[model samples]
Target: MSGNTGYAEIATFFRRQIADGTLAPGDSMPTQKQVRQQFGASITTVNRAFQMLKAEGLTAARVGQGTTVAERPRVAATATARLRRISRTGRAYGPKERSVDHQARLLSCADPDVAAELDIELHDEVLVRSRVYMKGNVRTIASFSFINPRGWAAVPESLSPEPLERFWQEDYKERTGRTTVKLPERRGARLAYPYELAMLKVDAPPNAAVPVLVLLNTWHDEDGPLEHWQDVFAPGLWDSDEE
Candidate 1:
């Protein structure tokens, strides 16, 4: 753990175990001391690695239970869960959840893919929001949401620091006198791009190029795409490629 080289060695080792089914959900992880001794990693490094896993929803530590692999959030990949969570709670991270970095903006659509998903012309102004979910020092997820002109025209509070799905709903209806509904989520995943890796601050998995778990979701109405959300989970977080 003298440098970044061995700092993540523990996480990489466990990720392989989890990915290859050598470690199943609920399987207990080695004690930090044991891992440190085994890998010759510093206690600080082990702690950071464990925290990263926990933040990624990969491992959980319970009272008297120690740390164990976490059960996959079978439904979290769906957009409905996210929408409901935001709408009901009016927030992304839990009130008790620590260390979430959030940023928002109303910017021109520069990415062609984003424009296409939002069903808007390229260079149009769109609302873009970025969030980095963090635990300790490691970033666990990088999420970006985009809303097209029609959706933004309603002046939805999509760029607010707080979750405001209700505001979006009310404003959209007040502006257009029409209600909008989110279609079933569309999911896809692939390797993280260079920018994604830089933003997420995670390493590519060993011997693999697919580093991040990507989930695509789009909200729509009678007209066209209203909002498109792209979430990229940090490396070694999501295990499946299911659609």
Candidate 2:
């Protein structure tokens, strides 16, 4: 495969192996060195393949354990499956409404992934929202968002648990006199740590990387800027645009 083809192919090859039952759960996969030998690809290419596998819930990596198969498959979500997914990056989808609590118990748990990069004490004050997204009866995705306290605190307490699209209708009007909630095109961001990967429920092969879309929103409060930040992601959903 061409270099540009490497990432997708690496993802597909392992997926095929699983579909064909050639690589079952708990089965060890070929090492990166071995895959490179077989495919004549670079270490980075192999790593990308591994990332695809992880994102698909095909494998897991541990320092001493190396990369091994995952016990269950990662459920790939359809575009329609993402109806309830929340983007922390303060972007709005459409106008809607709901009831929410003002002083919600937004807790910050201990995770090594976000610990060093952020001040957990600060995180303690950030808003936390969690929801499970589904398509029909099957659960497609589960998500949680952490908002910057300063800006999040400004949100009208009545809309606490509603989807961002619905929440922002009154959200914007209250924060700013304008009702328009426009956002820039998205630049994809990957969750930075293994703990974050766990939080996102992503699984991939050894050396697998997580690719996510992190949306950032700046809530305007009449006169000026409010530092509100939100993050949204569905770990293994919507890869090819086919679904």
lDDT of 2 by residue, 1-243 (tens): 444447678777776555333565567888988888777788898898898788766688877778877654223322221222233223221112122222234666354333322334533544556554443333334344444444454565623565454553366466745543333423366654564455445666656766655444443344343333334445654432211
TM-scores of the candidates are 0.56, 0.36
> Best-fitting candidate, measured by lDDT?
1
Candidates' RMSD to native? 13.9, 14.3
Error of 2 at 8 (Å): 29
1-243: candidate 1 lDDT, tens digit per residue = 333436566776676465434566778999998887777777888899899878867789988999998766331223454454455445443212233556678888889999888878889898887766554455656778787777766674665766554536568777888777766666566877776777776655555576456777777778878888888877776424211
How much is 222 displaced in model 1, in angstroms? 2.2
Candidate 1 least-lDDT 10 residues: 91-100
lDDT of each: 0.67, 0.49
Which segments of candidate 2 are over 4 A away from where they belong? 1-124, 137-165, 168-181, 191-196, 203-209, 213-218, 223-232, 239-243
Model 2 CA RMSD to the hidden true structure, in angstroms: 14.3
